[model samples]
Target chain A: MKDSSVAQRTVFFISDRTGITAETLGLSLISQFEGIPFIHVTLPFVDSAEKARETTQRINQAYQQDGAQPLVFATIVDPEIRSLLEKCDGFYIDFFKTFIPGLENELKMASANVMGRIHGVGDSNVYNTRIEAVNYALNYDDGARTNGYDTADVILVGVSRCGKTPTSLYLAMQFGIRAANYPITEEDLHSTQLPKALRPYQHKLFGLTIDPKRLHAIRSSRRPNSQYAQLAQCENEVKTVEAMFHQENIPYLSSTNLSIEELATKLMVISGIERRLR
Target chain B: MKDSSVAQRTVFFISDRTGITAETLGLSLISQFEGIPFIHVTLPFVDSAEKARETTQRINQAYQQDGAQPLVFATIVDPEIRSLLEKCDGFYIDFFKTFIPGLENELKMASANVMGRIHGVGDSNVYNTRIEAVNYALNYDDGARTNGYDTADVILVGVSRCGKTPTSLYLAMQFGIRAANYPITEEDLHSTQLPKALRPYQHKLFGLTIDPKRLHAIRSSRRPNSQYAQLAQCENEVKTVEAMFHQENIPYLSSTNLSIEELATKLMVISGIERRLR
Candidate 1:
């Protein structure tokens, strides 16, 4: 029997387009087998037969070197190129082939078989929507301009270094949501009422608070030994902002342990904000 | 026979986490059947039996109303919750179930079965790398600063509105690549040589050019009727920039028809920049 625990395997994520979908799903799948280490090779733009043959050779070489069959996860929409890849020595899994037929049958229509349609700019309207949202996020970031709050789908309120900027950009880039973030300044933190700028758009406000230690560490890296980066200052700001969220009845969450994805998702759920584009 | 051309169907993307993976893969799969109208519903954070039951009810209600089963694409990790979803009145496609067994057999190990592990902040190092990269992209965006060019993974040089900002941010957000962009100015377009600021980092530079008509339209939206938005001026700038790219031998691509995902992927392939994070 092969030594399953110690043997290292090579995995390939090949696709006709950017390979993003293949890599994303493949990464999530491989992450499950925690102990095994995987050497990943991504072959994107494998749309033609020539590129397919080249990738096949690479996969074979990996198999020969490792003395094991490499696992290949492919998401090619082109049948000709995909069939060429099937001749390779690796254990091939075609994401498109497995599901496209079911979908075609269900819809009583033929699959488009269009390459790069998923990640490419297939729909100009959708593409422009995302670009505009990204611009909106940057323009309104960190309360850079409070006048644009009326157009924001969601306004993130929190102290500096509490993870508002990244969350705002993530919402915009990923979901085409117009997100504006305002830093809860020390002056505002000392009071109980909501800031004058944020009071009008109170319905769009979502509060983010971070742990004092984490906030201090994040701030110290940017500006070391400053009073703003002190642990006591961080603690006071977090405490006051969280209390303001409670008193003002603003929906809030902690970003101390959550990734931007989790934080954005939580904000979307809490605010009942529907995504503008998919 | 059922009328396939006009009937509307509902599709649900259910997951224990953000439902992003499910939605992404499902949208790509369904986009193949072009004519079918699908009402998309995303149910994220369905980690509990109660939530699963509620989603099941929603799915069944859709089925009852449409007189057709809704299509459910799920990526839940917990077996108990997934099994409960399997009983829903819809066409159940379990993303994890279909692939986990094959992976387990290959690795000779048990799957972790961890909910939210894929999209969650499971690895703090990976999370921080992306956040830092995003900050780097913003700080160096649009030639905002010239000092950080040495630290960038790739520096994008292009004319204004040729799609550099989004591509830079997408690189940082998706692949943890530190990308900085510089907008080619009126003066830089008049000359053949690379800009003095970009001279030291010629090896790290990639050019982006867009179709002149598209460029004019894009600029016109931001600044109407200005000389910068004129068709002739856009044509002149694009021609000059393309000529400069040829002379400098800096790798370049047209962003006119490509999405940000496609642009970033092509840049990675041409520049041989491996992703820093998965």
Candidate 2:
């Protein structure tokens, strides 16, 4: 059912480089307004005054056509280009203008006016640490490198498709944590014992289990009409894994209904692993 | 010489769940100012009104102590709790207040006022795609699954430690791309030929080469006093990789002075890979 009461306003995210920052902040700001529908337009690579002028024209046209003022969220680094954008006929929120003068006053110096450096890329060493963590996560994935267990900060154990790999990788990418994952296969579940390789790293163990229905859905998509994807098999595996976690006194978390980012954060809180990024 | 004129202010990122949205938006806003040094405090899990009062008290205390109005960037969803925190003495930028009422008027509907959904986790299917892509990237890393190249949307080729794996993983995690990366060895570089395994996937191949100096520094850290870490070897490998890329007419980008995010964006532009996220 269409909500005829909702007002649809045009919103622009203009940036000199990829408009990720502008869009992230702009969308977040707009998300607060729940009842209104926003039509988003991202004008990336808007470094030149010509592009700014064109964007200004588009903003004005949207305002004219919509019979409402459009909202402009811009982070243009160039002063001349930002000034050009400021002339647009809309409710302008120049993120750059709002904060730069205050910062300049505090520092008593001019900013380099670099484009796309915020969350873009800065400090090769920090960048390398993140990349190295990713590489470590990749190499240590799925019990591929049992010998590297001592170096791992955390080792996730769960059934196939329980999201060990993604959670491990996210921990690595976002937190610079060296995470390794080991899949709990059918044999391990039947045996009701932690794998010998994992026993040594028990202190580092964190378990993930998904709801049987969600597990079945995920597995059936990959291997349909097979026993591995059977709902019965999923239910059995999850029950067994949860039992094993209880029997072995290992802490665990349900992978169901949790985003990888959220799962990572929860794991960090539980395991006391600090985030790599400040 | 230290800048004595610089001002330092306490900045708060308050949210009911993980403070990612508030922190990301707050940091980007703070990044615009050059000379001010920010002391960041992230107070998450403030879901209760009592906690909100405590937070307000803390904010007021910080303002009094610092003798400068602290910057309070918040995303508290509860109206009463937000109203409570708004009583604090500080430079408050209530993200919820700036847009919610206008949104309420436009949509003519009430927001769920849910906590932790923004940037925390949502949509099981989309989340699964990212997990599936990460698994795919891990499986195909370093020519491990060249047979799976047919399924890959992009294949990255580069000398060892030139950042093929991390770039591929980032693409998968952030964009839900089925990315595979293959390492170009000295043999492949010296022979000046793309490996037979890669020839069939020529259209998908993208090369990465790092600056020899930076590569030397990275390699030396990993394997000190080794032939691989020698500056001469680093120079030779980069030269060979660049030549092979030019001769083979493969699209390429430098892995130097670029963050994984930037590299991913440039690769998307060059290969025309659409981002899965809106």
True contacts kept of 1: 0.79
Error of 1 at B5 (Å): 4.3
Candidate 1 wrong stretches, greater than 4 Å: A1-5, B1-5
Could you tell me the lDDT of residue A124 within candidate 2? 64
Q: Which ten residues in a row have the lowest lDDT in candidate 1 chain B?
A: B1-10
**Candidate 2 local lDDT, residue B184:** 92
Best by TM-score: 1
Error of 1 at A150 (Å): 1.0
Report lDDT (Cα) of residue B190, candidate 1. Answer: 67
The residue pairs found clashing in candidate 2 are: A35-B107, A107-B35
Q: What is the lDDT of residue A24 in candidate 2?
A: 67
Q: Where does candidate 2 stray beyond 4 Å?
A: A1-11, A30-41, A57-71, A89-92, A99-113, A190-194, A247-249, B1-9, B33-37, B54-70, B88-90, B101-112, B191-194
**Local distance difference test values of all predictions, in order:** 0.90, 0.81
